[model samples]
Target: MTASHGNEIMVVSGASTGIGAATARELAARGFHVLAGVRRERDGDAIRGDGVEPVILDLTRPEHVRALADRIASDPRHRPLRALVNNAAISVNAPAEVLPLDEWRRLFDVNLFGHIAITQALLPFLHRSHGRIVNISSVGGKIAMATYGAYAGAKFALEAVSDSLRRELAPHGVQVVVVEPGAVRSEMAGRGAATANDLAAMMNPEQRRRYGGLIEAVVAHSLAFTRNGLPSARAGAVIADAATVRRPRTRYTVGRDAALLTRLARFLPDRVLDRIAAANLRPYLPRQGT
Candidate 1:
């Protein structure tokens, strides 16, 4: 076993499941003291282990965020913060016009503003330690599909925020990295499908006529993409590497699909990308009226 990274800490939010859970475990395995963030006591209990301490953290909750900051600041060990992985998110897929404004706000609340809240709170400690910040993004961040406006909107905004923050923090010895994973097999696929269907049911007749089939296609496509996606453990390792590497890249793309999609987004025109997206979704579209 490698020597322990005594008193060095890594903070990972959304550690209850999926990539967040895996990344928390991976960091602990790598010898860093990991503060894993979950939303409930039961989740915390489930994830607690050697070198891993689970904290109740729901990003949308102000009290929870403040409590975490206080805990870090007052730690008896006074561990230096090595990295902060912002991984909490909600997966919602619906047409732009069909998803209510409240839903859009909710998505941004968890996916974007929550991360910002955590980042802003911990930045003081990070500046003291010159630690890294890893934002978990997605392929959707770079390319919005037919029904991904809200989800991608937040991610795309995150990408832009990471860019500006990276430049702003570079001079201060902090490094900001974005990890865009195409798809990693996780519970999110199922949850997202449910969200999509729920939203589809609520759509007005005209809106359903326009987008009902499209919503079904997106859910099916999401499930298939996750089926072929990277394993959460592998994705976690990639993220751990991003957090701990001495000379980390500004961004890391997990899985071949992420690499391919990001590369295409960089080079392809909108029309071409549209056709490509349509082609991918074509197989999943519902057949007309049975």
Candidate 2:
């Protein structure tokens, strides 16, 4: 760790990779002792350098969340937890018509409910320290896309929850901010691609003849763009800034693309945006064949 204020400490969930890992590294570099929460021990070990204490915290597990809360609450440093960054989330893409209910539920289990569990668990510590909470929502949270129904649904729900939490926590001297990243160079893209592939495989031959190829193609193209998007370090900087700012706003849209896309989505009419998306995704349609 570099050197932070003696009283500053931070916790970041989903610290295994991508934006979460970058945020942990950046915070540690700033001299804050960071509790980097990860689901797997190997991931924890991998990110253990630079004063980051890797903690096994799967947000889906209430026991782990409670343990984390207990540790923070009992810390002698007495230094308030400077921030709690909820960055652990899963993105799934499937045809809404045929998407499995279990898949939808799983998305919410990690992306929405997990965040809530961790937040509720850590509330008392935050109350004591007057710390900040940063939820890593997405641009999808604002606008729903065709094949990403499940992921979009969870993100939208999370946005509402975060907004309400911000208002409710404000009076208690705790700051809550929602970060909506558009696309970032992260593993999430590959995972989304896998989900798309799985969905394509599940379609019947006639269904594949109709829409399966198109779905895969669109998801692949989107993933390509996402894989080449902004670096995670950039988003990490925004998260770090949100943590230390004396008066942080309720939302931070990280990266140039994220900022631009959000502006376009907001200013453009719903129909216009829909048409634009449709045009871009049209090329994936299958040609007549056996």
Candidate number of the best lDDT: 1
Query: What TM-score would every model get versus the actual structure?
Result: 0.97, 0.93
Colliding residue pairs in candidate 2: 3-31, 4-31
Question: Model-by-model lDDT, in order?
Answer: 0.92, 0.84
Candidate 1 lDDT tens digits, 1-290: 13367579899999998999999999999899999999999999989999899999989999999998998998899998889999999999988887899999999999999999999999999999999899999998999998788989999999999999999999999999999998899988899999899989998899988998898888999999999888999999999999998889999999998999999999999999999999999999999775
Give the runs in model 2 whose Cα sits over 4 Å from its true position: 1-3, 283-290
Off by over 4 Å in 1: 1-4
Give per-residue CA lDDT, model 2, range 1-290, as digits (tens). Answer: 12466566799999999999999998888888899998888998899996688999988888899889888877787766778899999878877877788888888999999999988888887888788899998888887778878888898899999989988998998888989987789888887788788888898888777767668667767876787788999888888887777777788997776787778888999999899777767776556577
TM-score of 1: 0.97
